[model samples]
Target: MAEMTLHTELPADMTDTRGLPGVQPEHGPWLRVDEAYAAQIARRIALLDDVPEQVLYLETASQGAAQELLHEALNIMPTLGFTVEGAQVTCPDGRKVDVSSTAPLEALGRCLQNDFVMMEKRGDEHVLTGAVLCFPASWSLAEKAGRPLSDIHIPVDEYTENVARRVQRLFDGVQVGRPLWRFNQLWYQDAELHQPRSATAPLRVGSNLPDGPFYRSERQTLLRLPLSRAVIFVVHTYVLARADVPELR
Candidate 1:
């Protein structure tokens, strides 16, 4: 589990998307990166292959979804200044992304700015079967791969006792064409997106105070794929200076 810092006063409405000041809603959770963040997006995509291979996991069952996700990304990128010319994708910044050489999942992960996880139903549970997690907060992609939703979230304090059953029900009831989103905020000592902890590390519940200079939040969305019957979990991470956060200030 990622180290979390709980606020003294909770937001009036946890589901209020406008609770955070300065952060614009823009296109909502499932975002399309424009020219402004083109450089950063390109840098992260270039670094994807270099990150620990374990950060990406594609099960044999998820191959179709991976391909579908790639197609979906290709169709979505043009609106964000990414144009596909044959097998090459040209970004707004003039960077050419050739996916012909890489695997479908890897190519899709590199092409899009959002981190994606594919969840498939297995018996009574929906498992985290495959994912391309480039910017994990404090959780390890390798540790979470192939685990059921309940098991993956077991480390989250009170998750099992509180939200587990409801979440399972939500996943079971989720249908194609009806996507949902939720936001999660936490204080962190560092701004880096990849913050994997060792198995021996203890889970800290509150902020480390002055040492944690970053206020991190993730906009998470869930949508069911019509063809694959797999749920696509997309996470868009935002890290701001602690001083910049209205609540922290």
Candidate 2:
């Protein structure tokens, strides 16, 4: 459960929306973006592609930072996929050079391919968000192009931690927990654990150990690799303000 005490004075023009963290909330109190934010959005967008199907996963400690990151993620959606063959990228010295796929992908690995962004609302009100081209595992041409190595679903624990670590980097000082919302299962084939459904009859929330490779427990049920290497993503929010006190009744 989220710590209810953390609620701050809702800034003017800011309202909370339940869906899509990176998306602009159309409806209550929302933080207003200033000229500086506008410039940051422009700079981030110029480095992105022209596509729109990309899926952005956004979560932030502050509302302003969340909004800024959302806009920035949208700006670069078009450049995320294979179509960015000859995009021009601007250098720090104001020099423009045609960007190739390799450099962008490498940049992405090192944190630059519209993969994730951190934005600030006022000064220290920071928010971190991530974006990726949400394509079906089989339908994505990029996945097909890359040679298939192993279909093994990285044990859920390992997979989640990999993503969680990246997520941790976005928010500098928070004890981010990894809580996953697991749904339907895919095919699986392993010698140790084999079954269409997981070993537990009904997977209990907060009780089942992190999903992944097993040690010596009888709790595991499913034994199949995920269809894609990248499966679950972690969204985290952090805050620097003093911890909130209980509401005065």
Candidate 3:
């Protein structure tokens, strides 16, 4: 694993001063690091602070052309919908305010999907490169699938046991990301699903899949869910080494 470090600095005048409503659960903090967007920001800051870490998963062979890797990372970012927001700090007695908004979380997810990394040219070959690791939670996928806040189906009684069991099994061997909405629609549209004699039925999106990364293996994670009527799905990311990509020459 190769490590790539990144640092970004901006002028003070460009800062943002907006604050998102804190996560207030029924009893405690409902969400960690605010929504996906906030979490991404916090993570970025942590990564850049102090001794600063580097993207270590990138193989040296992939680190040949800097522009190539950056371009690729930029292209993949939109797939996850990530943006950066500006932040501003207030005086000693006054409350610190925020004043920027960009969907960095979504972008980070997509970048991670493409395995965003920076490669450097060394001698005649490139090797393990550096990359920013991004793995999104289950809620990010649901939101991507167009599930609304009103869509989450919660019963008066908690089904933690049932939900956890079903999730563990159904999403086994999968990395949690975005639900395959298109695939899910097609699954529900299957002839058997509408047939009276069919034993299997499709489920709604929010009713089943909980928010979190569902891993299928050590190296692979689910990038999308199945297209069936089930709200839950497991999508895995399969990294293709340089050897996997077709030769340009």
Candidate 4:
């Protein structure tokens, strides 16, 4: 939850692609946000209770990772002014968060703005054990829970031939201290952050620009937990008005 410096100024070269073309993830996946949008994060966290089914899911196997993630968040977000006293987390703005009273996964979700997905290794593939995905791109957290990586991405175009195998290999080779991230961009009809549309939702091509007022992008990062050997996937969603994004024109 450190302030994101990179996004302090609006990005200029944003695109407006509508198709799910092949993914090309960069080597180093973690992004540093220099500017902190405290109000937006607070708003998203507050909305979580109203959309529990759309936002959080956890399996028995993921409980340990959930706790570990909560601990990690408490340690990393100190710059955002978080104080941990025993089981309580106090935010910069004086909102007290009781970690012990809330579910581990939910506690982790509420503390940060980014949505998190916890993946556990099973044989050669990674399984989606748990998540707090309040701002889904175009998928359902409930349906993806407990599914393998490949199965979870079944609806994505060109996933099998283009991104699936590579993602699996990346997960297997990722080390505990090292983290990596990449970006995905698309145009959306609306600018809301909590989009839980199914994969079958119609694509909004550039020709359909009149209907889409927002240009959406996600900064996705992957990190491995040293203890649980689980991978934590974090997605920070960004939405810009089409008028603000020159590429949309």
TM-score of each: 0.81, 0.19, 0.24, 0.81
Q: How many steric overlaps are in each model, in order?
A: 0, 22, 48, 13
Which model scores highest in lDDT?
A: 4
Off by over 4 Å in 2: 1-50, 55-63, 66-89, 92-114, 117-249
lDDT of 4 by residue, 62-128 (tens): 7888999887777776655677888888766577889999998788677766788999998879999
TM-score of 1: 0.81
Candidate 2 local lDDT, 85-162, one digit each (tens): 235444332334344332322233222212222222223322222233221111221222222211123233433545
Tell me model 4's lDDT, rounded to 2 decimals: 0.70
* lDDT per residue (tens digit) for residues 1-249 in model 3: 110111122222112222211111122111111122333344434443421323223333333333343333344333344332223323122323332232222233222322232222233222113334332211222122222211222221243545434433433333323321111101111111011111122333221433212111111112211221112211212111222222211
> In candidate 4, residue 198 scores what lDDT?
60
- The RMSD of every model to the true structure, in order and in angstroms, is 6.1, 19.5, 22.3, 4.8
In Å, residue 219's CA in model 2 sits off its true spot by: 32
Local error of candidate 1 at residue 68 (angstroms): 0.8
As for lDDT, the candidate ahead, 1 or 2, is 1
C-alpha displacement of 162 in model 4, angstroms?
Answer: 4.3
Over 4 Å off, model 1: 1-29, 34-39, 204-211, 247-249
Model 1 misses residue 9 by how many Å?
Answer: 21
